[model samples]
Target: MMRYMMSLLAALMLWALPAIAQNSGPLRIEITEGVIEPMPYAVPDFVGESATATEMGRNLSRVIASDLSGTGLFREIPAQAHISRITSFESPVQYADWRAVKAQALITGAVSVDGSGRLVVKFRIYDVFAGQELGNGLQFVGTQDGWRRIAHKVADQVYARITGEGGYFDSRVVYVAESGPKDQRAKRLAIMDYDGANVQYLTDSSSLVLAPRFSPSGDRVLYTSYETGFPRIYVLDVASVGRRVLPTMDGTMSFAPRFAPDGRTVVYSLTQGGNTDLYRMDIGSGASTRLTNAPSIETAPSYSPDGRQIVFESDRSGTPQLYIMAAGGGEARRISFGQGRYGTPVWSPRGDLIAFTKQSKGRFHIGVMRTDGSEERLLTASFLDEGPTWAPNGRVIMFTRETQGAQGQARLYSVDISGRNLKQVQTNGGASDPSWGPLQN
Candidate 1:
């Protein structure tokens, strides 16, 4: 009887531990589905101590303001129109001056050097219209070189508090960088800060590569390459640049690889004969199992955040559409009923929606829909906008956009889910097939 009672106690503890873990983290607001107008905000130059500190403060504030404004959710008031300059960091803000400039929200801060030589920053977000502090003021301490990260964190906090959605500005993206002409393009894997800073190439552009994806831990990337003269999946260690070709069936093309949420298995498309189907391979032992047996093209498999199901693109219905199947493989059900073809479906990390590239009316668009195919919303329309990759927080999407002209160009761009804040992301050359990495350490 005592053993049975102890067993019951253990079971109860196991269940209760998950609930405790879930409640112990920082609070996050859920952004609802709908359209809302952007809020007007004013972020003036933060007060600083030395000349270098002043310049750093202004640069950080400018970057933060740009980041917020580019989300299409906040409008930054021009500094020239400011009625008053922030002279003192500790003094109370003159609400009348902010109101006079038609600013609805205000952000102010101060930067100084701590005794230990680290940079100290204190910032606050204020609801000018509501005449109240939105949240507690926050402080960050880091080296001077980390000013951009500090600014991003500050912007993230402010964005989260105001919009109720998780912030994604403090993130990075890893993608295939393309250069040279269209016919003989030289492509190399690269990574950069989320805002297109600190670009670094990972590969030497000696082989053809496509569709790079970040592992769940963001420490490595899984992609397809033709290094051996045949399409094969390769895993790359981001830190050491180590490479490993995943072992699979000889002569079979394994492409469109994505790491399972557990980061131990990979789901990809394996082409046999003329048919492409989905399969999962264990990373450690290279043991493989077929997930889809249908003769249709099943590719671009993305695991649901919970790892229970996968959303992929299939042409079984005579036209390409989105479908969901169990991770262990089962009968797949189509979830897209829109007017045109959809491909490259990616499950959002938040598990709320799936983003895809839609080809309709002779034009392509980047759009998102609920997991069950409901509430389809197009976030971008263009001659060609493909490869919708979600930000770490899932509030924003980065995709490739191409324009036709005398000098046609392909560049990276990001947009909010509401079809707002269409801004170009700078790259060294033509960029496509952008995949955003998870938040870094």
Candidate 2:
């Protein structure tokens, strides 16, 4: 009996090992150069027994379909074309109807209220062409107020499954909100969900502020303020709105503050004695160390994703160019040699590329390049496109675009890494200096 039990235990361990390996496997995705035609999809109203469950099911399905359609990659078939209504949880799906409507994919779901009064949503995605479920259906439980997040999660899952790259729809953005006019712009630090919901003002428009950057932890923001009548760095806690002025040398102006990847220090540019240099400050002790001392302007210091090096813009070589320096403040090397002046250098979160704003021949552009400054590609060209901010996945870039006229406006725009899918982001008034935040939990 003991020998038999030992053999059974060994067999069980082997089976469990394979299950663990399968769970840890990288997600499979299809890669294509371009889609000549949008993929057709159908999203039917989900079924639920109760009124509240029915409403939530419908709304969640609508939002998820809308989010997918907005990407310009999927064409949502009209409900009129959907031949079968999802009436039962265990009902058989009519794949022929979806195929007849020329839908490559289909989404259906059901929702109900659990004993705890929270919503329980179950959803399934189908491949109409294959006449089978693409992946396992998922179930989620959340409060009514979290319906939007559930919608985003569903969209993200679909997007990742289709595109292989991660989805960025469930993120947030922290930007400098501008009002009044261009010259006397009343700017306040503001943050909002990626879908323009939950607008929270971090600082009152009492002082001039610029370039608010979210910390890696997404709990603090470091920005430059003219509150003390000079451009100085201030860090504000996003949760409690508590503010603290960073310690600096006397008669020095610090601006363009960005948190290190470790979230414990901030690197920014400090102008002392009319010479601008880079400095890193310890947030805990308020100790600062100079990084550069060249008799040139070195601003907009950004850290590489690994937190070992820094990329910044400097005019040390007659024209403004990008340079990389050690995090401990050492010898720096130039990285950009294009026929333009580059500024606002931002290292991509993926650690493979660096995004920056380039000016040349009376026009501005948003561009990215490899860390060694090779394979530079301009993503956007306009009268003025500056301050490039990378999405968390590093596949898209958002920047500020200003028109060229008396009534010119400034707004935020985003484009994929391939320079496709250009869309404008809505703001209260004229907006500029956008900083994309990390993905929220």
lDDT top scorer: 1
Q: What is the lDDT of residue 425 in candidate 2?
A: 83
Model 1 regions more than 4 Å off: 1-36, 405-407
lDDT of 1 by residue, 1-441 (tens): 111112211211211232221222232222323234456689999889888789888998998998888776567899999997886788888888888887777899999988888999999888775566777899999998888989988998888786555678778788889887776888889988899988888888999988999898888899889999989999999899999999988878999999998999999999989999999999999999999998789999999999999999999999999999999999898999999999999998889889999999999999988899988888888899999899988877899998886466789998866576678998889888888987656
Q: In candidate 2, which residue pairs get closer than 3 Å at backbone N, Cα or C atoms, i.e. clash?
A: none
Clashes of each: 0, 0
Given candidate 2, what's the lDDT at residue 380?
85
CA lDDT, every model vs. true structure: 0.83, 0.81
Cα shift from native, residue 255, model 1 (Å): 0.9
- Badly placed stretches (over 4 Å) of model 2 are 1-29, 34-36
- In the range 1-441, model 2's lDDT, one tens digit per residue, is 112112212211211222211222332223322222456788888788699989988898898887777666667999987887778767888988877888777888888898988888888888676677877999888887888778877887787775555777777889988887667768899998775666788889999999999899788889999999999899999899999999887788889999999999999998988999888889999998888888999989999999999999989899999999889988999999999899999998889888999999999999888899998888889999999998877877889999987677788898766666788887777778888888767
Clashing pairs in 1: none
> What's model 1's TM-score?
0.88
Candidate number achieving the greatest TM-score relative to the actual structure: 2
- What is every candidate's alpha-carbon RMSD to the true fold? 9.8, 9.2
